[model samples]
Target: MRNSRIPFVKYLIELLIVAFGVFLGIMISTYQNNNRTEKNIKKSIGFIHRELKSNSQKLDKAIAYHYKLKSSFDSIKKELPSDLAMENYYTQQAFRHNKVPHWTGLGMASMDNIAFESAKISGIFQEMDIEEVQAISRAYSYFDSYTKFSENLMEKLLAIDSNSKVADIIVIFEVLGSDIIITEQRVKEEIDKINSQLENINK
Candidate 1:
């Protein structure tokens, strides 16, 4: 038979105290972690929504240019022997007068959206919103098509030769006008979706 220095009652009490301490510490740590995660998610959503706003404005400007070109095309169709003046007007209208894309704003916007999405996905996964996703994903494609239309329009303008055909002018009006409408609709839908998600996050 072996005898311990401590009493059995005292040993049992000490073990219980240690287990309680460990459990309390765990509860505190877990609560803190949950709070921090919630804050981060909210922050991400806010940042991304701001980015989406800026990007939408830039795209909207492009859409305005498209509308202007369509108008120019309409009025000029009355005249014949399309010349330098008319072509130049159309080119300037089409390229937005050489207005460049807002890269800095766009970069910030992309980063914000990505961060927001990451934080969001980490928590309860919202059902995949692929419809809006598809529209949003098409931004670059819209730009690419419109850019080509712009360049080609510019070329036709430069080569006016004072004897341009009606067909040449009509081509630009057809392509650019149509593309702008599609892109504008897509951008609006994407903006609405982003706004809705951000509101949910904030609430």
Candidate 2:
């Protein structure tokens, strides 16, 4: 008896063709999406790099300003012992360059984490290695801590009264003087580390 059915080989070939077409479509789609992601990563990195660089510059200025304040306070401390006779003069000098405003601005200033944050929000950070995410988080954590310090310093500054004792003012200055030096050193180190990581990512 003659078979009416199509050969099994013919069906196999047809099914393979369909499978290949589907696989090819998927490959093309994946390639395009990967390319898009790469572009986005590069663009975001560029923006982050620029913002970080700017922040570094601002920090440098802030460090200098704080250092100057430290020097001023040192001078004031020297004269404090005998300055009772020179009360008005020393008091005026002590209050001369109130660092509160600048420090407040520095504390309140925003760091550019837009790229990092957006990446997290969009789940791109999940694609990053755990170490990379950790490094970024650690860097930002330092900044957050610094912000809190600034807030505390601002409160201290606000609490200063014209009638406040010179000894009290001196104490605040000494604390700030030491704190800022430590902060400046740490900031420089962190910036260098973060910039190195960013450059690696850019490459």
Candidate 3:
């Protein structure tokens, strides 16, 4: 009876050792995986930050261009006569002498979204804090809205007739210029928000 008990005890000890080894292996693998994920998240955030910075610079230039264009359009409108025939004659002279701004002169923002889109596609947002994700999403939505607005404005400008009276063209330009000004203000606000958020994350 004593010999049989000793063999059964040895078998139980071996089984316990095998279980311990398996648990240790699993713990090591989990640690390595978590470390890798953390590094990836940081790298992706860096890319996104750079992309945003580039976009902010682009917006700054666009804002300046739009302001100048608005001023020029306003001044030209004041110089033109209200009568359609006189306005058309002055418009022709202005075009011939390079006094008029072309419809294609307006600056387009063309904001960058590749980094943000890539991160979204790769599921990196899933790992981010919910608030961080929401803030970034909001910023990109502003970018989309601005792009669409600029495109539509350009389309309207392009559709104008070359023979249109100076008064009529100036009216359209003034209206569109006001919209551009409003959009620029909103974009500036978003840029400020983005800069603040970036500062917080960097800290």
Predicted model with the maximum TM-score: 3
Off by over 4 Å in 3: 85-104, 162-168
For model 1, give the 10-residue run with minimal summed lDDT.
103-112
Q: Give Cα distance to truth, residue 55, candidate 3, Å.
A: 0.7
Model 2 TM-score (2 dp): 0.77
Which stretches in model 1 have alpha-carbon errors above 4 Å?
1-6, 78-173
Ranking of candidates on TM-score, top first: 3, 2, 1
lDDT tens string, model 2, 69-182? Answer: 677667655655555533442356544435433343323334556766777787766665687667767776777777777787778766766665555555566766787668
The model with the greater TM-score, 2 or 3, is 3
Give the per-residue Cα lDDT of candidate 2 at 105.
31
C-alpha positional error of residue 123 in candidate 2 after TM-score superposition, expressed in Å: 1.8
Clashing pairs in 2: none
- The lDDT, on a scale of 0 to 1, for candidate 2 is 0.66
Which pairs of residues have clashing backbones in candidate 1?
A: none
Reference-based TM-score of each model: 0.56, 0.77, 0.82
Q: What's model 1's lDDT at 195? A: 63
lDDT of 1 by residue, 75-188 (tens): 554543545334544434443322323211111111124534563566522332455334434443444454554565567656754465445545555565576457565755
The lDDT of model 3 is 0.73
lDDT of 3 by residue, 47-139 (tens): 787888788878788777767777776677666555643456344665321355643466767889998999899898998889888878888
